[model samples]
Target: MDKHRNLDCKDIEAITALLSKDGEALNYYKTNGAESVGHAFMIANLLHLHANVSEASLFYRHAFNLHGKSQTEYPLPQSLLQVSLLCLLKAGQPVPEEEIKELEKYAPSYANYIRGILIAWRGGDVKEAMSLIGNAFEGFHSGEEIDALYLEIALKYFPALTAPITDTSYSPIPRHLYMYWDKNPPKEIADNIKYHQELLGEDFTFFNQENAEEWLFEHFGSETLSLFQNTKHPAESADFLRLHVILNNGGWWLDADLRLKSLEQWEMLSRLPKNCRFFITEKFLIHNDFFGTVANDPILANALLTCYVNMLKHHGLYIPYKTGPGVFSRAVSRTVYSSFNHDAPLPSLAIGTAWEMFSIVEEFEVTYKSGGNWHTA
Candidate 1:
């Protein structure tokens, strides 16, 4: 397997730097001192990684403009054009019929895969789309990682799959309040952490970046560390990591933006009947951002985390669904299925009233340049 398969933020940054420097590598099709198509493709890939779809499409278009649309003499040029078209289509932009007409002209074999995904996206049937894509690519065994991302995208668009839980059993309340940061968070985020720690008092252990990293390595080993680090989206990485923490160590997990309504509310939550193994906030559908579970909780520890880890390994990495709320939402819905459909109930599950467990105080003015929208205050 390729060493670059486990690409992390650090690796991405290094590749970007190399591509930027003069005489580094991959400067194909430069015209009259203008940026080369190869350079544009590299930039587009970076933007894609960051989930900046709008900007990525612009760069993709720029690359296509430098090279004629119908050229298939080289693999790199054809791949760039394919990605460019996909990005535009995925963004819900109007793709010229001419562009669609040219897909098979370039990569005849790969065009079917593209067509399958596009048809699925248009029809709004994620399952159908996945089936078509699987068939198109011969069961998706060779490019399993990319296939995983395709499944995640399908899940994000059409997310109606899940089962519900009637009740839950909670025993000992876990004292761990786990949180993580890719870097030192903003001042507001820092203040939010301090305030929550004070309210939770001595019982809770606030696992910051260092603490979280140390504990992750200690318990899960280096493989877990690489998996966590290789996650293309930091917010998704954090989301998946929290599930693992609760599964392994049992605890309450909260996004940084979430705040308690009052100290009394926390007291009440702490004293809730210790029967439910998993507690989640919900109005109608379950909110992915905040939740709680004890160590070795079967639903979270086994099913939910298992599903997430498998998806991550198989899919490699993706945005929106795979690394975002999509996976969490699917997991919650599956918990419902496990509770009702299975002859044996999966685990004790409870839904928390929104404001009582935590209040989402939306801070509109401050914006986060990175991470998920839920991470912003």
Candidate 2:
């Protein structure tokens, strides 16, 4: 199950059947009394992949209990416990005191981190929760999953703590709009681009495979050029490009598929306060796909710096944490925390309520005659 193969419908059906109560695999295990902690853990992972969070949480708990009671010589994998705790948290299920105590016995720092997230989720002391989360970043050598999860928890629960102090002294984000595609874009994407151009007129700039590299080389030099070239997917490359472009040019970076919901939304963008970075929050995570900021904004700088650092340390790891939303969210958190603690001068960051104001064309609605989905790539 850990093997890296793209799951097709048949594979999904088989896995679903195996986990079903009346299915042959589950029935056989039940009849033979052959269930093991390892098997249950596998079931939990499958459930998680299928997005059955509640069911996955139960399976993870079952695995944890089984591991504790079994006589197997192999020590329990720490990840099983950690992921179980995360699954429970994400499912909005209660974590037993005994389970938390067990986690504390094994990894005290991580236990504290989990407790911090729980505190924030439950609307306890905001300052204390932020402090614990900040400390957890320092205490643990977290993997990409942990980093992403931590950022999501912090942003979702303590958004105010992660927003930068507004400095009205800078300059307003320019009305310019930027978007990119790897090659010849599909009709839907092209249509969306045209629509934005109709709104912004000559302020709109589109980058493609031919001109995007030249632009990167001219603005950022060879190292950035090399990094852009080495990106594992078109989406990752776009992630790298958008940050640099916005940092240097100071304008709105819109995904190719995005368009304004109405003229009112366009007016809304125009009405945003000057010298402040603007972003939309969907489900508490700050989206990088469509953000506007002044040139050389520290938040954008930090996000780009994070991308470089993650690439150097964990090249080609998870894209979101490596160069996408995960790292961007961290940059926002760090900037806000620094301002709060040190009273540093920084631009005010505005987080809008929802992304629905700007419509995103669903991937399914477009036929990709050229470059296909970047994730699968």
Candidate 3:
């Protein structure tokens, strides 16, 4: 008999509610495999969230095993399988060759990434692992939570993966601050932009919805404008626009929600070597919220844009990634790789801050809170 078939609506509801109660849900699910494969998957997600890698892996294995007994669909099985490998990596265990090979049937592209990550993590090559993870997200596009989990797991093993750079060898890039919004800004966002503009003086440029669209059309013509209009995700368009504008006219690109902490922080970034591509690191992944480079760095940013354009075509302009940080990081990784072969010596990509240097003073309704609710505050 299929044990999971015995689960009732009440049992499913109870299992789901336990997710927010920490140890309660996981414990209940552990003792009650009859609770359903869905419950097992939920518990695995919770365990991953709490950074309980070993336990999460166990639950993920449980969920994966239930496939023969249950009716889970396509991508779910593939995602669970891939994340199990991540769980093993996070736990500091070498992923077995068989496990990587098994997942290859479901995701060939992902299989390659998992293999690369396995080698990198097992060999203690954190930098390569970081790049692989970033590139993986570019093609993956599952969910932000899964991406965060992957990043958290990598950071657990390599804490210095995003450590700050104190070297003063970098040149000063454009002093300009560039930000854009497709809609009217809230009071907090406007005030924050105003504050930065005041500090930066003539160097600040705040592009509103029309201004940004007009700038896109003016610079790239009707085809790019059509692409921007066709993309359903605001964040994707914002990300694409940011990189294009920065590549065309080099300067600082800060997310509207991210604010500079102080003048001293600005000064620190202002003094960096100008031509290098500077990014702010958060945990293991480079954040798209803050980064800058000198204008038109020997066709490097153009190459990055070309990569992104290709991604847009391949992914059909998806949200939270197709043109967002994942794509940005992937493009940077490719640029870095190409620079090695070419004598043009493309500007290097470096993490400028060890941790997130700016503060997100405003809260969005879409962002998840610790209490398992989306905060509108």
lDDT of 2 by residue, 1-377 (tens): 11221122235454355468434434433443324676666666667777666656656665665666432433354445666777777788786666677777766766777787788778787667666656455332223344444555545544663454353343478878799989878788888878877877787899986688999999989988998998888888899899989999998887876666655555556555654444545445667778788888888888888888877787856786678876777676676566545656544566654544344222225565345455533
Report the Cα lDDT for candidate 2. Answer: 0.66
- The worst-scoring run of ten residues by lDDT in candidate 1 lies at 1-10
- For each candidate, the alpha-carbon lDDT, in order, equals 0.53, 0.66, 0.61
lDDT of 3 by residue, 104-158 (tens): 7766656767765676656656555554554455455433333453554444443
* Residues 1-377 of candidate 1: C-alpha lDDT, one tens digit per residue: 22321223234455445345333231421222225566666666666666566556656655765665544633245565566667766688655556556656765544655655676657666544554444332222222233334534433433422223222333355755666666777887777778877877775556655666787799889877776766655675676677777778776777776655566545554543443333333323345466667677655544455345556565643443454454444454444434433434444455544443344222223346544455321
Candidate 2 residue pairs in clash (backbone atoms < 3 Å): 166-348, 167-348
Which candidate's lDDT is highest?
A: 2
Q: How close is candidate 2 to the true structure, as a TM-score?
A: 0.73
TM-scores for every candidate against the unseen true structure? 0.49, 0.73, 0.66
Clash count per candidate: 15, 2, 6
- Which of 1 and 3 is the better model by lDDT? 3
Clashing pairs in 3: 164-354, 170-272, 170-273, 171-272, 171-273, 171-274
